[model samples]
Target: MKIAIIGTGNVGSALAQRFVQSGHQVSFGVRDASSPKSQKASTIAGTTLLSIEEASKLAEVIIIATPPEAVLSLVAQLGDVKNKIIIDTTNSIRTRPEPYATAYHALKEITKSNKIVKCFNSTGFENMNNPIYSDFGGIDMFCAGDNKEAKALAQNLAKQIGFSECWDFGGDDKVELLEKFALSWINLAIMQGHGRNLAFKVIKRA
Candidate 1:
């Protein structure tokens, strides 16, 4: 998969490496190609740095790892996202996108694409970098969106990166719920000091 990650922060960097390792072509999309974040991301093997518009145009899958509010500004730069798969990995915890509750909503509205699912935002970047935890194995991931094919792609991407499972939290209405789920992770991992090493999983028995 050709993927362009918009944002070179912790979450973006971690996913970029994981995707690249999983045999996906990864690139960092940014306003400034020479910025410290972009330059640093370019150092990662199999990752390139391109302008936001340029990167979006070239990739089949576009992952927005940028801050929630920034999506408003990048909408114009996202170009014709019409039918591409856009996995939004941002939370509105610190900053909502105003008219939209989260980046998922914002992207869905502005980009005019239903192939947008919210995933990869539920845990610390450390966990995403390497989900394995001794005997426990890889941690679970979660996503929510209306498009069936989009959700499947996101789930497949999750599994490709060592996530034990990618639980479908349900459709569009469940997006905010998933974001809140992400906040729960943030609260416990940071606020409660339960540690970032902790993760969530579902156990079922027949």
Candidate 2:
């Protein structure tokens, strides 16, 4: 899979490394390819750096790991994403793309694309870097979207990156709920002092 990660921050960098390690083509999409963050991400093996428009145009999957508010301007630079899978990995906790509750909503409305999924927004970047726990194995991931194809791809990508399972959190109407779910993790791990190493996993009893 050709994956373009927008935003060279922790979440973006971590996912880029894991996706590359999983045998996928990874690229960092940035406003400035020479920026420190972009340069650091380029250090990862099997990854390329390009402008946001170039990377988005070349990718099959585009992961938005940038601040939620940035999505407004980013849509213009994303080229034509109508045929690509867009994964919204941003949370609207501190800020959001005004007029839209979350980045997922923003992308869907602005791009007018149904291939959008809200994912990888529910945990810390450390968990994304390494989802494995010694005793329990890979932790869980979650995704929500109206597009079945996009959701399936998001789930598959999650598993490829070491998540044990990527649960479906319902469709488009449930996106805001999923973002709230992310806030729950933030509350437990940061506000409640549970620590960043903690992760969520679902267990079934049969």
lDDT: which candidate is best? 2
Model 2: ten consecutive residues of lowest lDDT:
33-42
Top TM-score hit: 2
Report the C-alpha lDDT of model 1 over 1-206, residue by residue, as the tens digit.
Answer: 89999999899999999999999998889988778888888889999899899889999999999899999998799899987899999999989899888889889888889899999999899999998889888899999999998899999999999999999999999999999999999899889999999999889998
Candidates' TM-scores?
0.98, 0.98
Error of 1 at 51 (Å): 0.3
Pairs of residues clashing in candidate 1: none
Worst 10 residues of 1 by lDDT: 32-41
TM-score, cand. 2: 0.98
Write the residue-wise lDDT of candidate 2 on 1-206 in tens digits: 99999999999999999999999999889988888998898889999999999999999999999999999998899989989999999999999899899889989999999999999999999999999999999999999999999999999999999999999999999999999999999999999999999999999999
Error at 164, model 2, angstroms:
0.4
State how far residue 136 of model 2 sits from its true place (Å): 0.5
lDDT of 1: 0.92
| Model 2 regions lying over 4 Å from their true place | none
- Model 1 TM-score (2 dp): 0.98
